[model samples]
Target: MRRRVLNGEICKRAACREHDMHWKTLERILTFTEPPGYRLSQPRGSKVDPFLPIIKEILESDKKVHRKQRHTAQRIFERLRDEHGYNCGLTIVADAVQRLRQQNKEVFLPLSHPAGEAQVDFGFADVLLNGELTKVALFVMTLPLSDAICIQGFPRECTESFQEGHVRAFEFFGGVPTRISYDNSKVAVGKIVGNREREVTKEFLRLKSHYLYEDHFCLVRRPNEKGHVERLLDFARRSFLVPIPRVESLEELNEELLRCCTKDLRRRLRGKSVPKQELLNEEQQRFLSIPEEQFEAKRLQTVHANSLSLIRFDRNSYSVPIFQSLQDTASASMRSR
Candidate 1:
C-alpha cells in the first residue's frame, strides 16, 4: 500500500485508489485556457541599398571641389560621373546625399584657448536712423573661455574698416587676447596659392604682431569654428541695436551697446541670481593682459596734398597741413572747413 501511494499510482486503502493519480497523467489532463502572450513574425526580404556606394562617392568628390562651385546635388552628381567614374543615376545620387546628410553627425573637436584667446567676425544689420534706412556692419570679438564679447559699428566692411574696428575693440576691452581667430576675408587673407598654405595681408600680420597675439584663419567655408563670435553678433544686433533704432552717431551707438552688454543685459535671469558681469569679471582674471604700454595701431596711407592742402580718402576730401610731404605717408587728418 505504501509503495503504491509513494509511486502516486494508488492510495493507502484500496477504496481510496480511485482518487490517486500519476503526476504525469494529471499534467496531461490539465489544459491551458489562455493564448501565448507574444507572436513570432518572420523578417521580410532585404532591399538593395545601391545608394550606399553612391553616397560615399559623392562625399569624396565634393571634398575635392571648392565650395562656391559645389552648390547643388546635380552639379555634384555630374562631377562624380564625369570625373570619378561614379556611374549612378542623378536621382539615386541625390537621394543618397540627402540620406547621408541627415545621418551625418556634426563632429566637434576640443579647442583649447589660452587665457588670452579671442575670435573676431563681422555681422550685418539694417537700421532706420533719423527716418532714413541705413545699413551697417558690426564687428564682433569674443574671449572664448569667458564668453565676453566686444562689438563696434563700421560704415563699411572693408579692410581699412576692419583694421580700425579691431583697434577700437582692443581699446574698449583694455587688453588684447593672446590668440585671435579670423575668417578668410580679403582684409585678412590675401590669397590661397595651394590647397594648404595662404598668403595673409601685410597689415593683418602687423596687427597680430602688435597685439602680441597669434592670428589663426578658420577653415575655408567652415564658419562653425568661430561660432562664439557669430552667436555674440546675433545677441548684439537683437539686444542693443534693435531697441534703439536710431542714434545720433556711431559713438552714441557704441555707448548704448556697452551699457546694455555690461549693465542691463549682464543681469542674470529673474530668480537665478547669476550676473553676466560677474562672469565677465571672472573671465577677465583668466584673460591675457596687454604689455605695459599699449601698441599704437595706425592707419597710414600715401596721399597727394592738393593746392587746398586736402587729402582724398573714399572720395571724401580730408584737409592736411600745407608743409606735409606731398607723396609721403601721412596720418589721416580731418579738418572741417
Candidate 2:
C-alpha cells in the first residue's frame, strides 16, 4: 500500500519510503536507530558428554555391593572395564561417580512443611551485658511460613542447651513446629554412614521421641540446606540484638528477642502483606501440633556431700529430716512434692 511521507511525498512500501526520505527528516521521524555489526556467536568448547546410564549403573552397583572395603572406585572401575566390558575411561568414570555422589548428597524433593515446620540452628553473637563483654551462642528457630523467629542465648552449644532451647522456643512461640530441620551438629548427628544412614545422638533422639516429631539433618558440610534458620539468625542479630546494645539479664534479652520476633519482624511486607503470625497459625493447622504437655525440661543432677543432709531443687536445698525412715513412704512423699 502507498504511504504518505513527512515531506508530503507518497511511497508504496515503508522501506522504500525510508530509502527515498531525507536522512535528517528520517532521523526526526525515527526515535532510534539500530547499531551496526551485531553478530551472534555460538558457544565453543569440548562438551563432556554425560554418561548418565553408566553413572546410574555404577551408583546402583555401589549401593547393592554392601561390602565396605570392596566397593572402592578403583575396584569398581576395574570390574566395569574388565567384567562388564564397559569402554568408558577411568577418569570419566571417576568424574561420573563424583557427580552422582554429589547429586545423591541431598535427596531434593518437594517438601511441604505444615504451618508448624520449623528449623533450629545456633549462631554466635557478641553482647554487652551489665558492663561485661559476653560471647553468647544464640539458639534460633525459624518458622519458614511466618518468618517468625524464636531466639535464646546460651553460654555454649551442647545437647542440653539445644534441648533447653527447644523448650523455650516452643513456650515463646506458644506452640511447637511439627518437624525441625537440623544441621549435622554433634548434638544431633553422631555419624553419617554411606550418605543415607545417620547415627543421631542419644539426647536428640530422646528429644525427638518426647516431642513426637520428625527431625531432619542437612547433608554433611552443606549449611545452605538449612538456609532459613541461618537467615533468621542474621535477622535476629540485626533487628533484635544490634539495636539493643545493653541488656540487664539473659532473661530480659530473651524477652526482648521474643517481642522483636513476634511484633516487629513478624509483620507482613508491602508487597506480600500477610502477617507472619497469621501465616504461622494457618501453618500450625496443617503442620504437626505440640504434645498436650510440654516436654520435661532437663536439669543437671549432682550428688553432693552436704553437712545439713538435704536435696537441692533450684539454689535452695530442703532438709529431709535425718531421722526419717528411708523407705517407700519417704520416696513417695519426695516424688509427690
Candidate 3:
C-alpha cells in the first residue's frame, strides 16, 4: 500500500484505510525486504495418531538398544500388526518412526585419537572348519587415526577369547596401545553403576594394569564413539573373510588371516599416497613395550549344555551354532561335570 501511494497510484489516506494499517505501520512494511509466509490448508493429522503414544514408547525403548540392534520400520510394523493390532500401512509408520529417530539422535564432532590410542571390537564371519561350515568370531583392533588394524579369529567371544585377542593383538602390533576404546560388553565390564562409573571385571582390569593402558567405554547403545573399527568390521568380513576359506581349525585359519593382513599393508588405500605398511610400522613404534610377564586374562566356570543345545554359563545360556559340536563337546563337559 505504501509503495503504491509513493508511486502516485493512490491517495495516502485511501491506501492506509484500504489495507487497515496506520501510516507508520505502512511505512515500516514498505521498508522490509521480504514478507513472512503463512502456511495454508487444514491442521495436519496422522493415521498413526491413535497409536502415537505407543510409537513414543517404542522410540524411547529403542534408545536403550545399540543402533545396529534397534528395531527397523518393517520390524516395528510387524510388531504393530501382530501385537498391537495396528491397521495402518507400512509407509506411514516408517515415516513417523524415521522422524522420531531423527529427533532422538544426537550428533557429535568428528573424533581424533592420538597415535597410540586404539579401539577394540568383535565381528562375526562364516568360514569352513575342516570342510565343515562354521561361524567364527573375529576380534579387531585399530589405531583410529592411521587406520592400522590387527585382526584375529576366536571360536567364541568368551572371556578367555576376549583376553587372548588382546594379547595376540599386542603381539602382532609389537607393542601395547596406550589407550583402548571398547563397548561395555560383559567380557570387559561386569556392571554399570551411575555417575559415569563402570565396574570392570578383574581379568580385564588385570590386563589393563599389566599393559599400563587405559580403557574407555562408550555410552550405552552408542558404538559411534568407537566407529572407526565398527566400519572396518564390515570391510574385514567382506574383503578378508569372503568365500569362507577352508581350514583345519581356528588356529590354522587365524595364521592364514594374519598373513593376509600383513600382505594387505603393502597396498595403498583410497585417498592415501603412503601404503598402510609404512604407516603401520610408524604407528607400532608409538605403542608401549610389551609387559615382561604374560598376563592371565581368563576366567573358568563350569557350564552345561541344555536340552536345546545351548550352553549355560554363569546363569546365561548361549546358543550353539553346530548341533554335532553340541553333542560331541557337551558329552566331554557332562562327563567332567
Q: Candidate 1: deviation at residue 206, Å?
A: 1.7
Write model 3 residue lDDT over 104-193, tens digit each, in one string. 777789987878889999988888898888888899998776687788898888788898999988988788998899998999999999
Give lDDT per model, in order: 0.69, 0.72, 0.84
Could you tell me every candidate's TM-score relative to the true structure? 0.60, 0.56, 0.63
Model 2 per-residue lDDT tens digits across residues 179-259: 788887877888888564689877777788877777777777777777888887987798777744588787877787777
Task: Point out where model 2 deviates above 4 Å.
Answer: 1-114, 299-337
Q: What CA RMSD would you report for each candidate? A: 12.0, 13.8, 11.1
In terms of lDDT, the best-performing candidate is 3
Which tens-of-lDDT digit does each residue in 140-188 have in candidate 1?
A: 8877665667777777787777877777777666666667888889888
User: Which ten-residue region of model 1 has the weakest summed lDDT?
Assistant: 328-337
Each model's backbone clash number: 1, 1, 0
